[model samples]
Target: MELEFAQQFVRPILDKISSTPSSSELIIQDFAVIMIVASIMALISYKLKQPMIMAFIIAGMIIGPNTPPFSLITHVEILHVFAEIGIILLLFVIGMEFPIEKLKNVGKKATFIAVAEASGTFMAGFAVTQAMGFTFFDSLFVSLAISVTSTVIIMKVLEELGMIKDEATYLIVGIAVIEDIIIISLLAVLQSVASTGDLTINEVGMSIILVIAFIVGVIVLGSKIVPRCVDLVGKTNHSELLIIAVLGVAFGLSFIAFKLDISVATGAFFAGVLVAESKMRIATKIIATPIRDMFGALFFISVGALMDIKQLPLFIIPAVILIIVSFSAKFITVWAASRAQRLGKTTSLKTGIGLSSSGGELALVAAKGGADVGATSSFVLPMVGAMTIISTFISPYLIKYGWKLASRLESKGTGSSDTK
Candidate 1:
């Protein structure tokens, strides 16, 4: 029903772009449309106190080929390239912020929590999707998508609520870092599996070995080399040159990863890690942030653009079910893990709520990977996009109310102890 409406609505717009003589003009017009629409949506999102990333996505859905009315984007292929760059930069910045020292300091408790929560959520997601009658590969992709929380969203909400300095914040961030690492590694392995189109133990084992080797080789060698090169660039006192040099390394490593059939996200992340070891980490991050933001928006916009709104009604029920199951599983696993670490009940509850949001860049990346491989169901990407937007929308409220709930529970416990 929606498809018929979209087809009729999109025909004239497609014809107009097709008739346009100059390719460059079409590109310019597309950029203008994207920026103007995205800015407007972002402003509305701001007014509504929603995540800006969600705004960018909604903007894409509005202007993209999948929706009704003005389907403004003509050159989706170009946008896709930009989106890939966005993912690279997004992961790179995340990697830069996570230095080896910080990971080492994340502690056993945080490590345990991260692993436990990720494993539990992944299992739960798989089971739920399988029960929903999804294929094995679709279930695998969906499970992977929901296993990790959005570190960016969590931190942003924490800062907004003035809880960035809270004790639980540390553990939450630590667990997020570990989850990022694990997810990226899984992406690399998944890429390998996709490339070979074989699920045999030999192939799987080889893929894991290759991923480990690539990571160890880059870290062990790049740490010694990237820092000294960065220091030298810093001494030049040329910001432009510093930026170019860092991007060169990022793209350079990413290219190598691509050639090796690994996910470029893995390479870009480790590249940032290597750069972080340098004295110029702060300067590089400052230089790289705007670039990351721009490309990151493009990446998310592309994700939204790929969403088939016409098919959304078909997947809406599954998306809602997955959201509820995934969020509950994550919250329970995180809370239990925190409690096991001897974190107080209030802190544990806060940590659990803080990490409960199930969608982010990584989830979208995983969905995209599944789509690219053609190994998952057609509904996976759009379904994940829907889930992401909904979860991001509700996460802040959950955190805010979760604080009051935790406080009440603590009061009840105190009263019971007093009575005792």
Candidate 2:
């Protein structure tokens, strides 16, 4: 009887200790592990003067399911929630940085350059893919995939390089905003075409119209209501309450957008714009920055986790070809557009190099959507993911050095002419 009692008492404790963890517990442990690995890699990246994004990605790959020892985290799906949060917060921050006044100032010039560059890239990408003997639909998907720039990568790179104040930066950002809308619309069309075997112009147009109306409604209505709420919340003088309120606005708007079949990032951005218009903007930024950075790290790390380097060998040729063609096409097209806008040759060239990279959240999202609809081949997602990894490493370096290289070449040509 005594031994039986001891066994019964110990068995429950042992079971509690060794039992399979709940999904929620596993997710927390995984996130903790990810943070630890990310910190070390981030330190290394910083010492190497590399972008923190590269570090976070490398960290993700190390702990990803496809990597050695197969994912330290047991429940990846749960972790994806945090990753999505990261994306939402990142977009919110980007939106906060962009206010209505700034957009108004950059409006016409940005629109013209954005249209020119995006169209040029689309045409070039289409031609290149067709030449490679891809099906027309495949070609269309690939072209659209490469045409949109990664606003996240570009904005981060520009901010790191302290080029945000440059005239070219405004245009680059404006172009990205335009591309976001265009890509979303294209994805809608692609989905319809894939599902029904015919393009439904009416449906696509309606979606775009709805998205625009939502944005306008948020800006017009949110500007009036949100600031007043914020002011009342501010009077409470509770920092935590203030942070909560800001996030509520951010995620709440994003949720509505998702429900309406619009891009959540777009919604979050407009929400940020609304918040930015208020006196509480700076305080809101201060409160939200740390949360944003933490989530943003997860977002980039998630990007890395999605990558399977082993699959790269299978699609290596196509991936490499797409990277080269995409980069070259984007550069030439953007350079031409900037020149048409009367930017200096050097500035235009730098802008071209700045916008040359592909593969970002948008590209990955488009590739995934295409694959899901069977509009693209099975190889599309892997190829795009590989291209994004390659381009992520290349873009920052190009943005950092392109201007110097251009100046050096111009000086050499001038010297040669003077000698003559």
Candidate 3:
């Protein structure tokens, strides 16, 4: 009786925290575990010519919340903050890399391509969801979930391959980015509409107007005005001041966007792009580099640490279904778009595979939509994390095989010409 009483009294309390460590000490342990594992795996992935994102994801799966011998770093809020910082710097870096005039060169073809991919993926994901016996809304959510290609990893691969200046590459980037803009804009409206289950055309119109106004307003005002402000801050010429200056710009824009109910990342990206057009662009990167890396590491670490292996069983089918549909959707749309643009077969095939991968940010946006509609919970968010790793791992291999097919086509044409 005494043993039973003690077990009943103390076990629940211990189990709550032990079951899922909310204790600060446990969190610190989580951080240490994440950093060490992430670093080691990153080195391995780098040596293997793969994306570090893949390394991070695999590490996360190994050490996630539901897994046995849970990762040591689970309890730390520090990693969370670091991950957030990583995202900020990442969005800014994306903006910095996109040259404004260069975007003009991709205009019409890029728009058509983006629309085609977004539409195709939506259909495919939705159909698979229905065939798999999920509700229409569920199917829609999951389809949109995996539909878009990841911009960050794709850009890196393209740059490493020395194809950023290639017209086909630009087409992919432009279309993806624009589709991202539309998806996010819809997400903002969806959050409101989902909660109320009420639609007034006037109210919907106003929301659409606000979103458009915000994007246009940022480009016009932010591009011209924000850079000047950063320049003033940078003129101080103190290393510390420059660091503070860049942080201030990122945070200030992010905060403003938040207050206006826009994505902080979109704000950060626009701010960075504007800053890039200015003299202080180099200084901004120099100031932000070390910070970005530290946070970037933490971001991946948190990603690895946050995986809930417990949820894997539930997600197993949906996750696999989501990825397969997403691949088909992106491939057909991009190939058709390439053909429309009169691209050679080589460029068209290359563009299709180059874009088969998905982006983290798009999933972030759609998952938020799922939460807003009560269609998903915190659990669904990490599935996006899983899909990201899987797609990234396979994309490079696909590209490698694609190149060989292209080479064969070219060789056959050469042989035929000689016979003629």
Candidate 4:
């Protein structure tokens, strides 16, 4: 029935439009519609106390090609350009938040926990999927998708809870930074493997070397170059020129990374970090936030737009299974890692729940890479999206109640000790 409907109405229109390119006015109209819908959804999300990112995804679903009544977007390619810009800006802002000196203060314990939890999460994901009879490649994608926590969402929620000053929060943030570096490198390797269908040990080794070299080069060169450039620009005291210079550095490094066949996120992020060293970082972030938010909205919406509701049901069971397994695995792994670091039981629980709360932006980022390389199924985004939504809802509550639960236990233990 749907096929017939598409044949009668959708196909003919698509054919006509494909032959005759859409006018600039039509493209503008399409984008205007997207923004209008997104704005409405954003308001609803605000009222509902949900993440604006979730609202953007919902907006995409309503207008995306995969949903019913055909796609509202005639120019997906153009929208993609906006989405890519959003990603670049998002990473750049993330980088600006972490200066190299700040990273140096992340103790060895945090580093150990980060590695332990990440590796454990990956193994749990891979093992469970394989046990369920998924293909090796499918399992790999699923594992990668589930292994990392969402640093952006977690920090926002922690800030809201006023718990950002806690030791657990610092550990979580430190772990996330490590995860970002590893995951970005992994994405590069996975993309290579996906394209060629084979990756030798030498190739993998070389890729790791290149990744390390790139990061080191960025740190060394960026540290020296960015500060001087910012100082020169700052002498003018011109806000517009400063903004241009900041964005120029951001996009310039991103462009260089792309030309060198690395993840643009890595470049943009390191660029931000380098810029972070300047006395002008706070101002740069202030100027960049509005632009970042706008583009960031479009990027997440693009993720939602790609989701095919019709295809979702087919993958629903697998998605649910993955959600359960991934969530439990992350919680357990993080809890154990925290304990090994000599944190209290309650703190461990909180860390586990905090880390488990949302797959974070990294899940979707990984899903996008999986899809690009054909390393995973088309349902990867929807799967990660569903898990992200569930985790987002549960995370804050866990942070709140988990703390209460932990405190109660601690008090109880103290009372018993006194009685003894």
Off by over 4 Å in 2: 1-13, 130-145, 150-198, 365-379, 409-420
Tens digit of per-residue lDDT, candidate 2, span 132-189: 8888778787888888787777778778767777766766777777666566556655
lDDT of 2: 0.75
Look at candidate 2 and tell me the lDDT of residue 156: 80
lDDT-wise, the better of 2 and 4 is 4
lDDT of each: 0.88, 0.75, 0.69, 0.79
Clashes of each: 0, 0, 11, 1
- Would you give me the overall lDDT of model 4? 0.79
Residue-level lDDT for 332 in candidate 1: 98
Which candidate's lDDT is highest?
1
Q: Per-residue CA lDDT of candidate 1, range 1-420, in tens?
A: 888977898877888768845889889889999988988998999998889889988888988887886578899888789888998899899899998899789999989999999889999999998898999888888999988798888888779878799878888999999999998898888878977889999999999999999999999999999999999999999999999999999999999998888899999999999999999999999989999998899888988888889998899999999999988999999989988887777788878988888898899988887777677877899899999999888887887788667667768784121221
The TM-scores of all predictions, comma-separated, are 0.92, 0.83, 0.80, 0.89
**Candidate that would win on TM-score:** 1
- In angstroms, the error of model 3 at 336 is 1.5
Global Cα lDDT for candidate 3:
0.69
Against the true structure, candidate 2 reaches a TM-score of 0.83
In model 4, the number of clashes is: 1
Indicate the TM-score of model 4: 0.89
> Best to worst by TM-score, what's the order?
1, 4, 2, 3
Rank by lDDT (best first): 1, 4, 2, 3
Error of 2 at 29 (Å): 3.0
Q: Write the per-residue lDDT of candidate 3 for residues 138-183, one digit (tens) a residue.
A: 5556667677677777777667666678655766777877776656
> Per-residue lDDT tens digits of candidate 4, residues 1-420?
999999999999999868855588678978998999999999999999988878998898888988898988877777678877887898888888888998788778778777887778888889988887777767776788888787777888779878888767877888887777677767666665565566688776776677678889989988998978887897888989998998999899888877765667777888898989988898889999999999988888888888887887777787778777777887888888877777777667767877875466667777776776677767677777777666667666766777667657768884121221
